[model samples]
Target: MIPAIGWLLSSFLVAWLSARAAIAYAHRRGMLDRPGQRRSHSIPTPRGGGVGIVVASLLCLPGVLLGTAEPWPPRVLIGLLVALLLVALAGWWDDHRSLPILPRFGAQLLAVLLFAVASGVAGLSWWWLPVLVLGGAWSINLHNFMDGIDGLLAQQAMFVGTGLALLAWGGGQEALALAAGCLAAASLGFWCLNRSPARIFMGDVGSGSVGLLIFAFTVMLGRAGAWLLWPALILSSAFVVDASLTLLSRFWRGRRWYTAHREHLYQWLVRCGLTHAGGGVIYMTWNLLFAAPLAWLAWSHPRQALPTTMGAYLAAAALWLLLKRRCLRRRSNKDRHVAA
Candidate 1:
C-alpha cells in the first residue's frame, strides 16, 4: 500500500521533469507540430512529449522489479526494450518526417511481432498462430489509431491500468498490481503536460508504449479467466467505437477506408469549438457515465455476456449519434444540442 502512494508521487515528479525536458528538447530540435487545416490546435506546439512518458516508466521499471519473487525474465526485458527502441525511433521519425504509409506500418508490425516473440507469448497451436499474430497486429494498430488527440489514449490507459491494479490487489496478483501501480502513476504524471492546450504531443512513442502496456496487463488479467476480458474491453469502449465507426462510415461513403481523416466523432467535437480540455472531459465523462457501468456489469455477471456487451455497444452508438448530430447541428446553426 505504501508502495502505491510512493509510485504515484514519484511518477508525477518524473513526468513533470520529463515534460519540461522534452519541451526544451523539441524546441531546440525544431520538432514542433504546426497548426494547419484539419488540426484542432491553433498554435505550433512541441511534439514527441511522450519521450517523457518513456523516461518516467523506464525509471520505474527497475523499482517495480527489484527483489520481486516473480521477476520478469531477461528475455522479456530485452524484448520490450528492443521493441520500444524501434517503435519510438519510428515514431520520432514520423513526427519529424512525414513517413510514408507502407514503411511506417511495416515498422509497426515488426515491432509488435518482435515484442510478442520476446515475451514468449507465441501462439499455442498451429491454428491459433495466425490468430495470435493478427490480434497482436490489430491491437497495436488500433491503439495507434486511437491516439489522435490529447489525453484521450493516455487517460484511458491510466483508467484501465488503475482499475486493473485495483482488481489485481483483490485477486491476489500483488506483483502485477504493483506493476500496474507504476503505470497508473506514470500516466497521471504524463497528464500534467498533456491536458488542454498541450506542451507536447505524445506522438507515436507515448501512444504505442501505452497500447503495449495495456495489452500486457490485459493478457495478465485474462489468464485469471476469459470472462475478465469483458471488463477490459468495456474500459476500452471509447477507442473501439470511435475508430470502428469512423472506418465504417468512411467505407459507407466510398472514401478510402484506411486513409487519415478528421471525421471521427471526437475529432468533430474538437473542431466544432470544444477545446481540447473540454473534449477530453466529455469523453472521460462518457467513460464514467456509460463505460464504467459496462465494466461493472461484465465483472458482476461474466457469463451473461450478451446483455452486457449490448449495453456497452448501445451506449457507444448513442454517443456517436449525439456527438455527430451536435456537431453537424452547430455547423448548421442549430441553437443547441439535442439529447438522443
Candidate 2:
C-alpha cells in the first residue's frame, strides 16, 4: 500500500511539473490554440500540455518493475515503451506543426503493430492482428476526436484509469494496477489546470497516447480474463457512444467524417451555454451514476458480463440520441428567438 501510494504521488508530481514546463514551452514556441468557430474556448490557450502526462506515463515502467512480483517479459516491456513514445513523439511534432494525415496515421499504425507483435497478440492467430490494429487505431482517433473541450479528456482519463486500476487490483494484477494508478494520478495532476477556464490544452500529444494506454490496459485485462473486458467497455461507454454515434451520423449525412468539426454531443452542450466544467460534470455524473453501477455489476458477475455491457451501451446510445436531439432543438429555438 505504501509503495502504491508513493508511486501515485510520484506520477502526479512528474505530470504536474512537466505540464507546467509545457505551458512555458508552448508559449515560447507559439503553440497556442486560439478561439475560432470550430473551437470551444473563448480565449487562446497553450496546447501540448499532454507532454507532462506522456512523461509521467513513461516513468511508470520503473514503478511497475519494482511493484510487481512477476515482471513483464522484456519484449513486452520494450514494445510498450517504444509504442507509447512513437505515439507521443508523433503527437508532439504535430502539436508544433501539423503533419499530413497519412504520416500521422502511419505512425499510429506502426506503433500499434509493434505492440501487437510484442504482446504476442500477433502470434495468436491471423484474425487477432487486424482486430488489434483496427481497434487500437480507432481508440487513438476517437480520443483525439473527444479532446475538444477543456478538461473533458483528462477527467475521462482519470475515471477510466482509476476504474481499470481497481479492476486490475481485484484480479491480483499488481503491475497492471500500478500502471493504471499512475495514469490516473498523472491525469489528475493535469486536470488541475485543465478543468474549465483552462490554462492549457492536451493537444494531440496527450489524447492519442491516452487512448493507446487505455486500449493497452483493456487488452491486458481481457487477457487476464476475457470477461474483464465487459467492465472496461462499460466504463468507456460514454465516450464510445458519443464519438461513434457522431462519426456515423456525419458519415451518413455525406459529410467528410474524417475532417475536423464541432458536432459532438459535448460540443453541443457548450453551444447550449453550459460551461466546459459543467459539461464535464454532466459526463462525470453519468460515469458515476450509470457507468459505475453497470461496471460494478459486470465485474461482480463475470458470467453476466456480456449482457451487462450490451445493456449499458444500449442505454448510453439512447441517452446520446435524446440529449443530442434536445440540444439541437434548444439551439434552434435560441436562433429563432434571436432572429425574431
Best by lDDT: 2
- What TM-scores do the predictions have? 0.87, 0.97
**Residue pairs in steric clash, candidate 2?**
none
Q: Which stretches of model 2 miss by more than 4 angstroms?
A: 65-67, 121-126
Name model 1 segments beyond 4 Å from true. 62-67, 72-77, 118-128, 257-259, 333-340
Kindly list the per-residue Cα lDDT of model 2 for residues 65-102, writing each as its tens digit.
44478765667667778999999999999999998899
**Predicted structure 2, TM vs. truth:** 0.97
| Candidate 2, residue 191: lDDT | 89
